[model samples]
Target: MTIGQWYNEAHRALRTASTAMGRSRALAAADINAAVIARSAIYTQLARATALLVGGSPAAEAPDRARATAILARHGQSLTQLYVGLQAAAVVERQFPASPATAVAGPARSLRRAVDAVGVIGDILASHVPPGQTPRTPEGLAVRAGGGVQSGLADIARLTSAAIMIDIALPGWLDQRRGHLTEIYRPAAEAARWTANSRLSAVARELIALGRGQPRLHGLDVARPPLNPAPPVSTADDAVAAVSAARTWMWQNPSELTSVHLQLGTQLGLAVHVLSSTGDPTMIGGWRQAAIAAADLRATSPVGPARDTAAELTEVLRWLRSIGKGNHGEPAGRHLQQVSRLNSELPIMAATLHKGLSAALQRRDLFVKDEGVLQRPAGSLVFRAAERWRPAMRDDDVVQDLVRALVQGQDADSRSEHRSPSSRAFPLPPRPRTPVSGAHWAGFDPPSGPAVRRSR
Candidate 1:
């Protein structure tokens, strides 16, 4: 038979097998690996056929040459589809590491990488030939073939190399995260229950010392200052001390405070203390501490950044619970509600903050009065408070937002002291809008049955 005809037959077999595999027929998977093997063998034959055809072999006598070339092209397309299926399957498999043995052993699952590499080579080979030209040499004269095989080999090598890199990197990361989830964090959480009731002051001191070496765990120190201190201290210094301690503790032993409750308690406790201090910088720092504290709470929560921030705002609610409208008036209510609104809108606020920060950096201007504030200036403030800051940008954003809320909340509290109820009720400026989908064809009306009156 002619080379083209043989390739056609091979192509037909592969197509049928692929269809069966798609339907997830057991018979197809059972023998799918064998089908790929057979397909690979046919590809080798096709390569040989092309070589023979290029060597001026007779059209009728050396039909295998023509058949191999055509078959290789068809097979290349089929294997491309096979590679796609394998990649999709791999993605599923990644999500379910303990998949059934049959899944692990299936042809689409196992030979996916190999099929993809080989398929890439086949595509290169297929493209080299002209559509109607007999793969056999013209006029029975032989010609030397070069580049086609080399190009295919190069493509196969590159794809195979990339596949190997993905295989190596993905598993290592997953294994590490799994180990943390299964072995480290889970056990620590169980142990934390026993430690929660320990002397808040003593625990605070040890956590502070532990935090000194690690700046991020600043909030964990339980000796954190009181929510509101008297005239002598100003409360802001105490808040800074609490933030410092908590930041250090959380940074070093983030594993300890895995739940939202712990995160909020740590943050608000620090905020209240910082707000009590007399110093301006310390008071401002208290605001930052509040924001950071809230962020830390969110970062540790199970609901991801969006829900975690909302959950973290429960700390603000806790703080409010302690001192309701005591001479602060409805302005306090408005401010608290604003904070609640921010907490509810954490995800969007977080995004806006990021964009604003980026814009500020680009504009080459400072948003705050102190350049040192923008620079993350150091002090015993965080060192003496609770713990150090947590790792990751999401954590920072949460803390920053809490700080903003505290600062703004205080401003609202002070401003409400002077403004009457009527002035405060006018709707505040609207926040930036978030994107949501709308129907493109919502307002469109379909044309009538026929343009009957068009022609006069």
Candidate 2:
């Protein structure tokens, strides 16, 4: 079923539970059985929705996917609390048979409130569902629901605490439910951080190499080194700090260097902004400042290689800024944006550097000939070095491949947009098929389905 369908089913089941719990008196055996069946139905639908949302299949847009996952989490937690309240009610009926009326009132009241809380969550989910979809609810129903559900949840919390006083085991069940959600989201979070750090470290190393090599080749005396050794990167924050430090180093120790060096510094600064500014509006100012700095550098640079390099840098920065302004509403989208920028800009930067280095080497070789030197040609050494660094900077196909993989995982429709026509002519290798068993589902383990495989 589509995620929308599953969510609809969950809402229907929640309504059934609410109806069954309408009576203020203690729940009879039939009422309890109905509630249990409804709970099981809701659980199944919620699990299906979550699996579909996070699975390999292309689902909704990134913003919709994020909202759907949050709805699933909130409803799942509410369902758990509802079931706990039901169980506590049953315990109260069994423990105080003499005054069952008063004993069950507290639990029944809490169960009713819990059902209302679940209804409120369903309203929120319904708000995001597209119009004309099956099993739709009134649009903007959540706002009309008075937004008091948060306070209702606090009341439920107090009631659950009272139940806890009566049933010592209640906390264990709540903890188990919380732990299930933690386990599901933790791996995805860690994987995202690891991917960001890896990309950041790679770019930092490239920039450092360019900074050190360019000055020596041009025979320019350095006032200060362009960059120090890259700091150890164990986290995304550490990677950001390292990239920021590189930018600071470049700015603090300004020297006469090639336009390629300036381009690399501009790219590095932009990378810092993209990595660190996931959702912050203030970071846009920093990104614009970096662009302005590059423009200023370009204005002062001489004609020839410097002018050409600055022009390329300007185009790259403009493209990157356009991407930054796009509707990348999630952190995953921001990461993919970073990858896309790198894949597009790296080859141009490398070519510019290679051209400048080659020209410098040719000039040196001519000077050597005019002086009647008997040493080996400088072209040999420079070409050898170029050959080594050329593949690292020029061969951007590896980065393209990474971007393809990431786009596949995040948004499959964007794959075509990331690749050029020539690159698209060559297909990527097929990925291995892996079975997604019930064990892989985050909160609830539903029945297993067919294996999922990804290919280009």
lDDT of 2 by residue, 209-316 (tens): 333411111110111211223334433333323332332232222232343444454454445346432322333333334333323222124344333333433444
Q: What are the lDDT figures for the candidates, one per model?
A: 0.30, 0.29
* Candidate 1 stretches greater than 4 Å from native: 1-253, 258-270, 273-282, 289-321, 327-456
Span of 10 residues, lowest total lDDT, candidate 1? 135-144
Q: List CA RMSD, all candidates.
A: 31.1, 25.6
RMSD of 1: 31.1
Q: Candidate 1, residues 99-149: lDDT per residue as tens digits?
A: 333543433343333443344323322322323442211111111232122
Q: After superposition, how far is residue 218 of candidate 2 from its true place, in Å?
A: 51
